[model samples]
Target: MTVDVRLITESEYPDWLRAVHTGFLQPPVASDEEARSRRPYTDLARTRGAFEDGRCVATFRSFAQQITVVGGAALPADAITNVTVTPTHRRRGLLSRMMAADLAAAKERGDALATLIAAEYPIYGRYGFGPAAGVAEWTVDVPRTGLDRRWSRPESGRIDLVDGANVRKLGPDLHDRFRAVQPGAVGRDERWWATRTGAEQLPDHPWTEPFYAVYRSPAGEIDGLLVYTADDKWGDAKQPLNTATVLSLIAVSPAAERALWHYLCSVDWITTVKTGRRGPDDLLPLLLPDPRAARITLQADFLWVRLLDVVRALEARTYEAAGTLVLDVRDADGLSAGRYRLDATPAGATCAPTTESPDVTLDVRELGALYLGDASAVRLAALDRITEETTGAVARTEALFRTAVRPWCPDVF
Candidate 1:
């Protein structure tokens, strides 16, 4: 049987949605009204569906976005999401065809990069996607007092607890302000905010009505906000011990971040607090009296970024130390293929083709690894994947390409 690939039309939305929910095992399929609400932001033209005998078997959606790089420049990018294939259609190469078609479309649209939070990691690596960000989950016993002494009494900042539903509106503003100065942070559009907060006039998830707390500095400027929910007696109580969990917490500024942590730790009647999906370099240690009370679990996988245009992707981000390096990138799939010289300084980077002075040669996947700061040039060279001709070119390239902080994405797409 041959599978047909085509754009999903408005009339076919019900079938498409049904296939998606069943394929992904999403509980309780979304209603027609809910689907209608999501239609505006979704690009139906970019949504592809594979069908066998007039039945939808696979589907995916792609949307264009303006992603702000670590340094500050905005680049045209594509976010591939909502990819799912029916069980009956699995291992039939439907996904590969869909992805290839979508990527080709994105390339034709002039997208320089593609990003997504993979539902499964292994499936994406073959597509040239590399893990570009990570989230660290932490647990702490509130009574341990490790956080007590280090926790400075927060200065006067106006904090207002608002309805969680209102978070959809306020989150974008807070995120926009936060990403402006933060390196390796991506921008969130309305659709992204709506999906995260479950507020796009869609069928909502009852378990996820998170509370929003907005923080204003003494100067009366809104600097930070947190979306969180408290879970009481969350763990096994049979052992004579119980715990509380802080489901989510996002702070936009350093002061606001500290204040939010203080508030969470001080919540009464909670023996322990569990916070999942936070920055790898979260400031809890600095604010805690005993840093030992904060137990951090280092877990990988967050956002996967694929460079569609090497020059644009390389030049978009800021460099730490200054240096010039040549990159010989091999793309097995022929998506990103080129040899270019990246001249990077503290200011930014300028990438162009070079006929001489080759410093490093690596594959596109390795380049993706380097771009995310997950694998350094020296490490790749030692692994025999990156070839370095000069004495300290590896070190120089690593230093020049290092991000301001370890790349982390607290939000799962």
Candidate 2:
């Protein structure tokens, strides 16, 4: 049985769409209304499919994205999404065939790296991808965690609780500013903003009515946005405690962050406030009188990265410490396999192909893990995923790659 893999043409979009929905076990989007709802999430030209007997059996696509690396440089990234293979085509190597073509196309298009929210943890690692950054779930008790100077100093800004309709104007600009300061952050496209902020509705996933708040800075700049929903609940003692679940909280400045959290905690009848996601190095717990105030319920890798162009990806981001190290990077697909020397300084890193002896040896996956400045070289070496070919190489590599704020990707896509 032969499976043909290629980009779906404009005329074949309906079949391609159905194939993707089916692969994910979603009901066929049969009507005009349904199609319009789903259209924003897809780029028809970029969507790839695997056809067996003239029917698309697998689906894949990537959004045009720029991910912020260490030192505030945005690297061209292909944020892969809508990946699916129908159960009928399971274990047939359809995924591998499609992934290879997609990755090659992305690299040829000059995207330095590829990123995705892994539907399954173990699948992407073999494709030269590694778990780079993760999300943390915070459950905070509203009663104990007061907003009085715990999160930040007294703020001159005020949070105005707005509606979903108003978010259409404020969200995109605010998020662009927010992703800039954080390393490993991926930019959200217009489609993502519309669907996520409740400006547009999609099929299967019903938009839950949520409250939107805008944080205005002292100088009257809109810098932060928060979207959340509440469910009124009471304990056995009839306490009027409701639950406020934070869907998305984006703040461009420390003052804006404090104001958003302060507003949520100050909401009337809110018993517990929960967070959708935060970075592993989040200072939420420390902001309260009790360091153990926010209980992190879930801690798991949220973003997986694949270094498609090793030299390009390395040179795109800046390093903190100054050093020179040669790396022998092995790529299973041979796309980025080569020895590259990386010279680092406070300014930026310059990486190029070199014939020099490597001080460290590793696969593209481990390098992807280190690309964002989260995973340490010594840690990977201890796990045998990385090899230190020279004395003191691991420590030197660690010092060169350390980032002030651990990388965190806010958007799921």
Candidate lDDT scores, in order, read 0.74, 0.83
Clashes of 1: 4
Question: In terms of TM-score, how similar is model 1 to the real structure?
Answer: 0.89
TM-score of each predicted structure versus truth = 0.89, 0.93
The TM-score that candidate 2 achieves is: 0.93
Alpha-carbon shift of residue 211 in model 1 (angstroms)? 2.6
User: Candidate 1, 203: how far from true, in Å?
Assistant: 1.5
Residue 59 lDDT in candidate 1: 90
Candidate 1 per-residue C-alpha lDDT over 126-171 given as tens digits, one digit per residue, 9 for 90 to 100 = 7778777767777887788455534434677867777756677677
Each candidate's number of clashing pairs is 4, 0
lDDT of 2 at 379: 87
